[model samples]
Each structure stands twice: as structure tokens, then as C-alpha cells.
Target chain A: METYIFYGIAIIALLVSFQKNRAKTRSALKKAWKSFENILPQLLTMVLLIGTLLVFADTALISKIVGKDSGWLGVLLAALIGSVTMIPPFVAFPTAAMLLRAGAGYMQIGAFVSTLMMVGVVTMPVEIQYFGKKLTFLRNLLAFVFSFAVAWVIQGVVG
Target chain B: MKKGKMILKRYRFALITMAAVGVLLLLQPQIGMKAIQNSTFQLQQMFFVIPPIFLLLGLLDVWVPKTTMVKYMGEGSGIKGILLSFLIGSAAAGPLYGAFPVAAVFMKKGIKFSNLMIFIGAWSTMKIPMFLFEMGSLGVKFALTRLAVDIPGILMIANTLQKMLTAKEVEEIYQKAETLLD
Candidate 1:
């Protein structure tokens, strides 16, 4: 999978760098660990927040919220759920399929999926740690708003 | 002892949150248990994706010169920068939050702000593996439709944000990134 490819590239690059200059390779590893450790505290907290949020936004509740024929209400609920929650896309798509089967509208699912990818309410603190408050806020706000367009387009083309 | 204190200071928010979660467990056992499971699940994903990214980022930091990044993705790097930004982002494998650190590194390396935003956009929505999965779960038509809409939206967002942030703001962000890497 993609993980395998990333591991392969990283190992190969590490080997090449080692052969070229051991010190440089060592420094690279150190730098990597430092940066990761610097963010670890925030990252851990974000994961916990996502966990709590996901518990409330579980699939059954989501399907209920965005039921078919719910129209804009469903889209709004879906977008709000997607914005707040942080489910992995791998799990999310299958769950989306299940929601669709359970009578959720495509427009709602579209909003949910798009916002799920683009907006990260729970991860805002970690984002702010790296991106600064202004840019992070602006970026997520923009993504959240644009997700409705994504929903509309998908509904038009596929739903 | 000092380092331990520093670590605790840095992790104060996490500690408070964990304490709150414990309180939730006492108050609502069912939801609390589920939340714990969900948190562990997220932790699993984070471990799988985070290490290699930081490793690659580290390598990128040491090996790639700022000049090289600028030549390709900096101001006036133009269409090539845009394409490269998209490719780097689309090929990525982690959550959008993961992209922020990479974006920080990009800023340190002098990548153009717009290209950096494009990279973030690509990471957020156009990820290739995620796209394939979306196709499988949501149908190819829905997946493709989102991708088509997203491409333009990504560009518009990056440009709009670029316009919104003043030159001083952008410089300050880059400076913040530089210090962060150090």
C-alpha cells in the first residue's frame, strides 16, 4: 500500500544519505525526531479530542441525522458532523456507503465526506501550533464553506 | 527534574484533557469506554503514518537546499511549482494535520505561500489512495465529481488566502516556521 511505498522511499533515501555522509544522515534522523517530539504533545491531545468527538458522531447517529429527504437540514448536519469529527477516510468511506444504504442522501454524504477531508475542528490546536492562528482559522473556515459546493456538485453529477 | 517539568508544562493541556476524559468515564461509562477505544484507534493510525513522514521531512530538510525548493516552488516558480505542489500533496498518505508540519518545513525552505497552500489542499482532498477508496465506496462518479470540483476550489482557496494575508503576515509565518525548525 502507500505505507509500503513511503517506507521504501525513506529507507532507500536513508541508505543513500548514509553512504554519502553518515553525519548528515544522522542529523536528518535527529531533526526528524526533534520535530516529531515537538509536536507530540499537541498531536496526542488532538487524537483524544477526535476520539471523544467520534464517540458522539458514531455512524448510526450520523445516518439518523442526515437521513434521506432531509434536504438542506441533512446537508447542514452532515457538514457539521464532518467538520467536528476526525475519522480516517478508510473507515469513513465504507461508513458513508453504509449510511447511503441506510437511507442517507448523497448530498449529505457529499458534504460529510468533503468536510471530513478538508476541515479539522478537533485538530485546530495542532494546526495552530504549526500554521499560526490566523492562517489556520482562515484555512479551515474556507474549507468548511467550500465543502457545500462539493456537496452540490456531487449531488448534481452523481446523486 | 527540570526537563520533566518542561515536558509536563508542554503537556498541560493533554493532562487536563485526559483528566476530563477520566471524569467522563466516571460520569458516563458507556460513552467513555467507546471514546477510549476510538482514541486508541486514532493512535494506531497516527503511529502508522507519522514516523515515515517525519523521517522524509528530516531528510528533505538536510538534503534539499532552500534554493532548490525556491527554484521550483517559490515565488514566480509558476506552473511547475503548482504542479509539483499538487503532486507532493496528492501522493501524501497522512491526515491533513500531518500536512501542516510539512508545510512548515516548506515555509522554512522558502516555498511560495500559494504553492504551500496547494500542497495542503492536495493533502486534504485530492490524495490518490483516498480517491481510489472514495471511488470504491461512493462510486466512481461521485469520487470523480468531487475531484473535479476540488481542483479549482483548491486553487481558488490558495490564491484567495494568499491575497488575504499581507506581506508582513506571510513573512512572520515564515519566521515562525524557521524558529520552529530550529
Candidate 2:
């Protein structure tokens, strides 16, 4: 799995760094912990918000909102839902396919998947901590608008 | 008491949400329990996925000189820098939020603004593992079409975002980054 690969690389790198200079390796670990702790507060809030959002926007409700023949309005709804909720791609893609099978249109799925990846309503607090307000706002807004274009293209090609 | 107050100040939002969850549990136990389970799953994923990323980031910070990073991803690195940004971003694992910390480091290292945006765009949508999952689940056409549009879109968005920022603002952001990850 990808997780193993990441851990593998990290551990090997850590060992090499340790062998080269103990002080440098220790500094690296210290830096890593500092960065992690820096974001922990926002991360916890984001996680809790995502959980609550997911509970309200379950599969059935999502499918109902974006079902086939739901039209452009459905695409909008799909994009909004995607923007607000944070689901891992491993879970999201399969759920999207299931939604498709459950009468969700290709355009709707396109918008959902696009915005789901690009826009992070819940993660904005953490994003603000790094990039500040204007950049984060513009990026998410541009991405949200771009999701519609993505939906249109997918509809033309795959729908 | 002062330390406790500082902790509360930092975690005010989380504490509010926890209190909200308590209210939800009282009103609708089933939904509250589901929310708790979902939050636990997310927390587990974060614990599993984040440590290694931070470790690698730390190593990157210590080992990779700023000049080296600037040489590859800095202002004049051009097409090569853009391509490298996309490659690094797409090859990465974990959620979009995970990419932000790495991005902070990249900014601190003096990566070009547009290249940084491209990296973020790639991390958000063009990840190879996610693309493969999309192909399997949604069909090759769906996956390819998204990629086809997304590649160009990423470039356009990055450029546009870079343009939208004033030079002074960009400098300020980079200056903020210099201290942020520390």
C-alpha cells in the first residue's frame, strides 16, 4: 500500500540522516513535531466538522439530490456537497460510482468528484494558517467554478 | 492556570464542536454515535498517514538546502520547474490538507509562486493513485476525461492565481512561510 511506501521511505531516510549526523537528524525530528503540533488544533476541528457533515449528507441523500434528470441544479448541489465534505478518494470514487449506478448523472458525478478534490471548505482554517485568507479564498472559488467546466467536459465526453 | 487557559484558547473551536456533539448525543444518540465513529476513523487515518509525511518533510527541511530547492523550483526554473512540481505533487500520497504543510516548506525554500500553485492543484486532483482508482471505478473514459481537462485547468488556474496576487502580497506570503513551519 502507499502508506507502507511512505513509511519505508521516511524510515530509510531517517536512518541515513542519523548515520550522517545525529544532531541534524534530531533537528529534523524536532522540526517535524513542531509543524505537526502547529496544526493540531485546526486539524482536530476540521476532522470533527467533516464527521458531522458526513453524517448529514449520507449516500441516500446525496444520490437523491444529484440523481439523473436532476439537471444543472443537481450538478450545483453535487458540487456544493463535494465542497463541504471531505472523503478520502479511495472511498469517494467507489461511492461516486455507486451514486452513478443509483441514477446519479455523469455530469453530477463529474461536478461532485471535481469539487470534492479541489475545494476544501472544512480544511480552510488550516489553509488560512499557511496561505492566508485571500489566496485560499481565490483558490477555492476558482476551483468551485472550474468544477462546472469539468462537469460540462465530462458530460460531453463520457455522459 | 495560565497554561490551561492557553490550551483552551488554542482549542476553542474543537471544544465547541465537542460540546455540540454532546448535545447531538443527547438529542439523537444514533446520529451522535455515527459521527463519533466517523471522527474516529478520520483520526486514525490522520495518525497513520501524517507521521511519515512530517518525517520526510523534516528531512527535506534539514537536508535539502534552500539554494537546491530554488535551483529546481525557483523563479527561473521555467517549464522544468512546472513539470517537477506536477510530478512531486501527483506522486504524493494523503489528503489535500497534508499537501499544505509541504507547500509551506516549498514556499520557505523560494519555489516560484505559479509552480507552488501548480503543485497544489496537482496534489488536489491529479494524484496518480487516485486517478487509477477513478479509472477502475468509473471507467477509463471518465478518468481520462477528467485528467485531460484537469491538466490544462491546473495550469490556467495556477497562472491566474499568481497574477491575482500583487508582488508585495506574494513577498509577504513567502515571508510568512519563512516563519510558519518553524
Candidate 3:
């Protein structure tokens, strides 16, 4: 669904740009390809890393690691796993619910979900390519800490 | 041969990981095959979503004027800039890495640093469709509470990050952006 919308807009934009100026349209296409190629190496590496991490940290293992009685330590572990693994929301939420059913506490699940969305240890290479090292690390570190706050708030409200 | 060497240097990390996977395949076939499947699935998702995004980014670079971007999102664009950043970021439809290229374009077009961070924050967590999914899957209380906490949290984080960088560092980032797109 989201892919379609992106394609729709991109094609329309290309057509409009072509109508306006053929040369400019061609440059846009070139720029698009260049940018995509620029990050391909890092992206390939990230995809493989995510694959390995996901296999080891599969749902069953994750649930067992962050079970309900695990407390703050579980939240830390959950945040660490979330930071390293890059799961899409479509998979992440349902997995979170499953973990909850499997006895993961709200705080741990909250930390997991928050870090999963915000911090990206796997995507760091690509991010550093764009923003440089300092900003990228700073942002992720801050987000890692902030996930704890998110965990606590969710626990208070939902648990 | 020289070109091949350059390509090898550029893709060293990927090659190393591939070799690791190969070793894993030899030693632990089941886990290795599952990893390969997982990587294939991720690669498929990337191909589906990434092409059009890069295309749109290209069009945006060619079409949108720096002056216009600055007027709306630069320093002194103030609250309006912040709001626009949040809107654009929240309306986006990919993983966080997708946001970085868009952000590079934003920096090239002279968006304020804090607003750029805000945009990233929103892109990271406040996505509307994702929010709907969260509500349905995690319960309304969890979803709403996360949303409520996240808005202020994003602002605070963005502000702090913006302040943490030296003026020289921020300028260097913008200079880097100039090279990234061109």
C-alpha cells in the first residue's frame, strides 16, 4: 500500500518534470540512481546483520529473555535487542503482543518497541554516511536512554 | 582491475559479512539458511519501497528551490518550520534509514538543525499509519500514552542535540550535505 503511493507520486513527479524540461527530468533520474547506489553497500551489510540478529533473537527467545518477572534488567535487555534489530512495525507490534502474552511485562515490551523504532545500531553505517559519526551516535545514544522513559510511562499507564 | 579493487574496498563490510554467512552455512546449515531467507525478505522489502523514494527525492532536489525550503524550514522559520517538519516526517512511510536521505536533501535546502532533528524524531516514532497499527495491536491506552509522551520527548531531545553540537560542527554537517546530494 505504501509502496504504491510512493510509486504513484514518483511517476507523476517524473512525468511533470519531463513535461517541464527533459534534461532536468533526466538529471533527477540520475540523482535518484546515484543516491541509491551510494548507500547500497551499507544497506547490504545491514540487511545481512539484521538477518543474523533476528534469527538468534527470534520471538520465542525474546519472550523468554524478557519475561514478566524480569524487571528492569529485562527492560535493558529488550532495549539492547531492539536497538540492534530492525523489524518493521507490521511485524514489531504483533510480535510485541505475542511477547506480552508470553509473559513479557509492559515495561520491557515498551522499551523494546521504543528502541526498535528510534535507535538503529544496524543502520548506523548508513546514517553515519549522511550525518557523520558524532550526530548519528549522539542521536542513537539519546534515544536509547529515552526508551527507558518510554518504558516507564507505558508501564504506569498500561500495566 | 583498479575499478574492481575500488568496488571491493567500498563493499568490504558486505563481503566480510557474506563470508561470515558462508562459514555459518558450512558449520550450521539450518541457522545459516534461515538467515539467508531473512536477508532476502528484507532485501525484497527494500526494493519495493526504496526506488520510488529515491526518485521522489531526486525530483524534489531538482524542483524545490533552496529559498523556498529555507523560507519554510530554515532558521527563523520558527514554529511554522517545526510544524512542517513534524508533518512531513510523520506522513512518511518507510523505516528510519529512508528518512536520512530525505534529511540530507533538507540540510542541502537550508533547513534548521533543530527542525531537522525534530523531523527525524517524528519520522522515527510518530508515523500516523504506524500509530493506527499500534492502537489496534497494543491497545489504545498504550498507543495514546506513547504518543503523548513522545511529542514532548522528541522536542526536548531535538533541542538538546541541536545545542550539543558546536556551531562549527553544525556548519560542517551542512557542508557535508552539499557534497552528498551533488
Candidate 4:
């Protein structure tokens, strides 16, 4: 899958780099580990938050929150949840499809999918580490608001 | 002892979050069990993809000179820089979190702030494999519509964010990136 491609390229690069210069390649790996360690604390925090959030906002909860009859309120709720949780698109798109089949409105799903891709409340700490507090908050806030725009467009054109 | 305290300070929020998870377990075993299972699953996914990513990143960091990255994606890289940003972002795989470390490297290597934002925007939204996957799961109409809207949306968002930052704030971020390496 996607995992294999990353490994394949990484291994190939490592071999080639190793062939070129043993010392330089070793330093590269060392620097990689340093940055990974720098981010490790925030990364661990994000994983736990995502776990708890997922349990609370399970697919059933998502369906209930964004039912077909809910209108704009449902779209807002869907966008909010999508912004808050960081589901990978692979699971998210399929879940969205299932929700569509199970009586969720297309507008709601549109908002959900858009925000799910564009925003990440759970990963805010990690983002903050890189971008700082004000910028991180602004970025997510803009992306959150923009999801509604995306939802509105999708609803107008497709739904 | 001082070193331990520094580690603890850095990890305090994560520790508290784990403690909260433990409290949830005590209060509600079933849901908590599911949460732990979910965390482990996520951890497995992380180990699977993250190592190779960091490794490749490490190699890039060592091998690619800053002048080259700057020439291609830096201050005067222009429309070509923007296009390269979008291309790299769209072609990327893995979660959005993966992009941050790579982005940190880009910053360290002196990529323009706007282009870096473009890379981030593209990585978050227009990833090609995920786009194709979206088509299968959500239908061409929905997936294509999102992409069509997102292409413009991503550019606007990236540019706006770039413009919004004060010069000092941007410099501070670049400085932080430099420190992140050591």
C-alpha cells in the first residue's frame, strides 16, 4: 500500500546515500531522529486526543449529528466535527459515502469531507510547535470558515 | 534530575492527556478499551509510515544544499516556485501531520513563506491518490467538485496567510525552524 512506497523510496535512498558517503548519510539519519524527537511530545498528545475524540464522535454519532432533516444546522455540525477530528481521507471518504447512503444530506457530507481534509483541531499542538500559537490558530480558523464556503459550493453544484 | 525535569516539562500536556484517558478507563471501561485499541492502531500506522518519511527527510536534508532549494522555491522562484509547491503537495501521501516536519525542513532550507503555505495547502487538500480515492467513494461529481473549488481555495488561503503574517513573525518562525534541527 502507501506504506510500502514510502519504505521503498527510503531504503533506496539510504542505500544510495550510504554508497556515496557513509559519514554524511549517518548524519542525515541523526538529524532526522533529532527533529522526530523534537516533535514526539506533541505527536503523542495528538494521538491520545484523536483516540478519545474518535470514540466519542464515532460514525453512529456522526450520522445522528448530521441527519438529512437537519438542514444548515446539520451542515454546521458536520463541519465542526470534521474540523475537530483528523480522520485520514481514506476512512473519511468511505464513512462519508456510508453516511450519504444512510440518510445524511449531501450538504452535510460535503461540509464534513471538506473540513476533514482542510482542518485539524487534534493536531493543533503539533502545528503550534512549528507555526506558533497565533498563526496556527489563524490557519485552522480560516480553514474552518472556508469549509463552509466549500460546503456551500458543493451543495449548490452537486447536492 | 534537571534533565528529567526538562523532559517532564516538555511532555506535561501529553502526560495529562494520558491521565485523562486513564480516568476515562476507570469511569467507562468499554469506551476506554475502544480508545486504547484505537490509539494502538494509530501508533502502528505511525511506525509504519513515519520512520521511512523521517529517513528520507534526513537524506534530503544532508544531500540537498540550501542554495539549490532556495533557487527553486525561494524568494525569486516566482510562478515556477508556486507550481512546484502545488505539485509537491499534491503528489504527497500520508497524513497532514507528516507535512509539518517536511515543511520545517523546507523552511530550514529557505523556501519562500508563500510557497511553503502552498505546499501545505496542497498536501492537505489536493493529494492525487486521495483525490482518486475520493472519486471512488464519493462519486466523481462530489470529488471533482471539491477539487475544482479547492484548487482556487488553497491558493487564496496560502497567500492570505502569507500576507497576514508580520515580517518579524515570519522571521521568528524561520529562526525556530533553524533551532529545530539542532
Top-scoring candidate (lDDT) = 2
Q: What is candidate 3's lDDT per residue for A1-159, written digit by digit as tens?
A: 645766887799889899999999999899878867777887788778767867777766655678766789999999999999877775577567656755678999999999999999999999998889999999999999999999999999998
Better of 3 and 4 by TM-score: 3
- Model 4 Cα shift for residue B174 (angstroms): 0.7
Q: All models: lDDT?
A: 0.83, 0.85, 0.84, 0.81
In the order shown, the candidates' Cα RMSDs to the true structure are 7.1, 7.0, 7.2, 7.5
Error in Å for residue A100 of model 4: 0.5
lDDT agreement of model 2 with the native: 0.85
Q: What TM-score does prediction 3 earn?
A: 0.65
Which consecutive 10 residues in model 1 chain A have the weakest lDDT in total? A94-103
The segments of candidate 1 whose C-alpha lies over 4 angstroms from its true place after superposition are A1-64, B1-70
Please give the TM-score of chain B in predicted model 3.
0.63
If you superpose only chain B onto the true chain B, what TM-score does each candidate give?
0.63, 0.63, 0.63, 0.62
Residue range B26-88, candidate 1, lDDT tens digits: 999999998898778656755675566667777776876533444588888889999989978
Weakest 10 consecutive residues, lDDT, candidate 4 chain A? A90-99
- lDDT-better candidate, 1 vs 2: 2
* Candidate 4 residue lDDT tens string, B41-130: 766656554677677667776886534444599888999999888878876666898899888889988899989988988999898757
Clashing residue pairs in candidate 3 (N, C-alpha, C atoms within 3 angstroms): none
TM-score for each of the candidates? 0.65, 0.65, 0.65, 0.64
- Candidate 3 residue B96 Cα shift, in angstroms, is 0.7
For the predicted complex of model 3, DockQ is 0.46
